[model samples]
Target: MSYFFQIVVSGMVVGSIYALAALGLVLVYKSSRVANFAHGQIIAAGAFITFYLTTTVGIPIFFSFLASMVITFFLAMSVERIFLRRLIGEPIISVIMVTIGLASIIDGLIYLTPFGTENFSFPPFLPQDPLSLGGVSISWTQLVGMIITFIMIGGFSWFFKKSTVGISMRAVSDDQFGSMSVGISVPRVFGLAWATAGLSAAAAGCIIGNITGLNFDTLHAFGIVVFPVVILGGLDSILGAVVAGIIMGLIQQFASGYLDGNWGLNGTGDVMPYVILLIILLFKPHGLFGIHEIERV
Candidate 1:
């Protein structure tokens, strides 16, 4: 029972990170309808920047985290301007392929940096001691990560619900032509969406780095995994993203905790989500929270 509780605690920690990561993907998809394959690279860049600032440049970790968020904001915006802006109104397949290409390009660029290959940890600022409750232990790093994630998620929820810019984004998502007729600059909204997504990606990266240590490979892989999260939650719903992310995280933890080494399953955690995703796609194509459009057959 204690062991089961331990897995649940860890699952929440990991699920929170997934929720943060999926938030960015949902932000971009909500406004632009563009699935960003380059998201992982942006995440990797954010993690590396934080690592560089804290370790090499001698800045504090907190400041480095904010700086990385700012940097990726512009980095993602410029990427939008250069690569995606021209491809506006292009076929969806073309746009997706372009983002995939951009992801590859960023991966190649990161590979040139020493940080890409090396493993680095944040400076020891948190207590090494673990907090315990009835035989379940949680570390400070994970606790902090979860706190930051919830704060950010709450902030984003408020943004989408109350902010002017966020409402404008929702308008565009609902009907681009209708929004444009009302004088909303659709392109600008798209850019802003990408920018916000980038910012969230950076925050997620920093938190993950602090908890798991800085590793380019590990940080970027979240990009791919976020697809299942977004799909399960409904691609355009922020609430869906959060709920789905937690669900996926818990599912992953439970699988790895109980299913591994039973009947020769090596890595159930890594593969099960994708399998579930495919099953979801086949049946619940609109996802749990996705808006349903009825087409008369």
Candidate 2:
């Protein structure tokens, strides 16, 4: 019983991270209708920057985290301004290929640094004790990471609902021509959307770094996992992303705990989520929360 609850708790933690990761994809897709293949590299970049700032630059961990977010915020925006800005209104496949190119370029650049070949973990700043509740335990790093992720999620939710720039983004997403007729700069909105997604990616990177240690390969693979999250949650729905993230997280954790050891299954945890994704998608092609966009003949 305790073991079951413990798995549940672990799933929530992972789910929240997945939710955070999916935000980047959702934001980018909402504006440009292009998927970013380079997002995992951005995540890795932010984590390495945080680690560098904390260890070598002598900044506090919290401050380092903020600094990394701001830095990546600009880094991502530059990628858009320099490489992608001109590609606006081009074929969707062209834009997607550009993102893949950016991913490979970033991969090459990171390889030149120590973070590319070496594995590093953040120096522990929190107390090294796991908080136990009813025979279930969670560490301080996990608790803090979860709190930060939730706070960011709430902040983004509020931004989309209330802020002016956020509203502009929403308008552009709905209809770029309509937004432009109303004097909104569609290009600027697109740039801001990418920047905002970058911010979210940085935050997710820092959280994962704190929880799992900074491994280039591990952080790099996270982008691939986010596709299912976006698909499960509906690419255009923020609320759906949040719910889907938690669902997938819980599913993976529960499968790992319950089905791994007793049966002949060895990697059920890794395989089940995709299986479920295929099954659910067969039923709801637009995803659990995706809008049913209709085209009139």
Candidate 3:
């Protein structure tokens, strides 16, 4: 039972990270309907930037974190402005291809840096102690990361529900044409959406980097893993993203804890989310919170 509880605790931590990572993807999709393939690259960039500032420039961790967010925020906006802006009305395929290309470009740029080949961890800021209860233990880093994740999530929820800019963004998501009719700048909203997503991505990256250390490959993999999370949650639902991310996290942790060594199952945790993704697509195609659209001729 203690072991089970321990797994639960660990699952929650991982799930929180997934939720934060997936939030950005959902934000981009919700507003602009753009599936950002370069998201993982952005995450890597944020992590690397934070690392550089903290280690090279000797900035404090907290301030470096903020700087990284600001940097990525503008970087994402520039990507949208320079590359995606002109392709706005183009086919979805065109937009997707552009994102893929952007990812490759970012990858190339990172490869030119030491981060692409070397592994690095954040300078320790949290106490090097583990909090334990009833045989379940969590490191300070994980606990702090979870707290930050919840705060960011709450902040985003409040922005969406209460703030004018957030309301405008949501309005754009609901109906771009309608928003334009109401005097909203649809393009500006799109830029803001990307900017916000970038900001969230930076936060997620910093958390992950602190928890797992910095590795370009591992950091960027969050981008691919997030797809299952958002899909399970609902492509355009923020609340759905949170719920699904935690669910997937639990599923992964439990699979690793119970199924990995039993029988021939190995690496089940890594594969389970995609398995569930397939099941969801086959049965609940609209996802848990996704609205089913009916187009009538």
User: Pick by lDDT: which candidate is best?
Assistant: 3
- Look at candidate 3 and give me any clashing residue pairs: none
Give the residue spans of candidate 3 off by over 4 A.
none
Judged by whole-model lDDT over C-alpha atoms, candidate 1 comes out at: 0.91
Candidate lDDT values, in order? 0.91, 0.91, 0.94
Candidate 3 lDDT: 0.94
Residue 72 deviation, candidate 3, in Å?
0.6
Clashing pairs in 1: none
Better of 1 and 3 by TM-score: 3
lDDT score for residue 121 of model 2? 95
Span of ten consecutive residues with least summed lDDT in model 1: 115-124
lDDT of 3 by residue, 66-173 (tens): 999999999999999999889877999999999999999999999999999999999899899899887889999999999999999999999999999999999998
TM-score of each: 0.97, 0.97, 0.98
lDDT per residue as tens, model 2, 1-297: 999899999999999999999999999998878789899999999999999999999899899999999999999989889988899888988998999999999999999999998989999999999999989999999999999999999999999999998899999999999999999999888888889889899999999999999999999888888888889998898999999999999999999988998868777877777888898789997888888889999
Deviation in Å, model 1, residue 271 alpha carbon? 0.5
